[model samples]
Target: MKIQILTHTYTLTIEVETQETILEIKRKVEYYLGVPISSQTLSVCDWELLDGLDLDDYPIVTEGTKIDLTINNHIPAIEIRRQIHITVKFSSRKHNIEVDKTETVGSLKEKIHIIDGTPIKQMTLWFLGVEMDEDFRKLSDYGVDEYSEIIVFLKTTSRMVAEPPSRKLRFVVQTSSALLDSTCIPLEMKDSSTVYELRELLLVRKLLPIDDYIFIHKQRIMRENCSLRWHGVENDDYLYIFKGTVSRG
Candidate 1:
């Protein structure tokens, strides 16, 4: 079967036996591409590839059941080694690591990629996860860890990324000194009590604009119609408040 193994900026394909398992296919591709198995991953949906189902359940690899694979192994090319400095943000902690001159962005991601099993390509990594911007490519685009603190987005979950991060952040005016203009609000509160309930005791004195908006979290973004009352808002989260009228259509 024809398969697409995609990395940050490259995609390669190879024909394989229909009996191959995901883990098995992963190893072969890693070997063929000179990438490390430690850094690569395979993605198959429960319905399409039946992610959790056994390989035997997949039947035989057919002609065009295309499975898109994102190969994350970034290996520094065969070249002289040089210490390149870079600032990497993992969770809430940011660290400066000096890597070889040949390191790829795929390599950098593994160091900070969540162990909970979320693939690097699926995660939206950022400078504080928001604020000023520039979309960052793996080491191929920019050299890192020079000397000073140069902020960058380690990963983008979006493709077609035709452009990098925009210099201006979309801002919405808020009535209080509390709610971030960047924070997202629920679309239609179940009731006035819903809004009051969502805002914590710390936000008791503050009054939200009572606008319909979506609550975007690290894991999920709740629509305005749903309850945002303690669905999970973290301090690390930087919300984007919608300025326009809410729409469900």
Candidate 2:
């Protein structure tokens, strides 16, 4: 019963009961956009209505419904997403980020700002093939597997005169869970990884003492294998990591 609202400006997601009327939905929309229900105009299922219609009518709107509202000329659209993987590129570097597809593009921009170490105001996300006038679909909707290529371009113009002109680049994103794990896990094990894979796995989850040596099951692993599988550890395996100081016994 999930539906998306593609308006002639902004997109939003909302939940509703089966028995609710359009007026009830309008109240919710009013709360979201800070617009009065009396002033709000609603269109469901691509049909333009002069007056509001009950959600319980011929077209049953359910949870995850995308509601569109227009303030002026800008048209905004919303869609329910199962999973979204977007690749962002800027400043000669590329990053792939994944989120629950239900997340809004506006919110996703905030995350890109953190990962790219840039301010949110400076970033704008644009889908190449996706029209600004069309409803945006989640990554899962397009069968974009873990390796599917979705290019995202980033541009920023700083107020500083010394800064260079903004630019664009390409990045690929996928919907695979394993890809996500591999992508992120490498960062945690990159340092001296050849000798401490297993240790990092469990140790990263804990606060190790600065001056203490770390090991597993009495096995000191500083110069040993860092490969997780080398310690007979599978991707899903769990092991305990302990921190201890060298004692003159």
Candidate 1 lDDT tens digits, 1-249: 455554443354544455656666665444344445555555545234433444556754455444555434364532212346566554555677655434444444444443233454444444322422222344434534455343434455444233222131222222212235334332322221232244432144353544433333332333332223222232234433322221211
Q: What's the TM-score of every candidate structure?
A: 0.25, 0.27
Clash tally, candidates in order: 14, 9
What TM-score does candidate 1 reach? Answer: 0.25
lDDT of each: 0.40, 0.40
Candidate 1 colliding pairs, count: 14
RMSD of each: 19.2, 21.8
Candidate 1 stretches with Cα past 4 Å from truth are 45-56, 59-61, 70-249
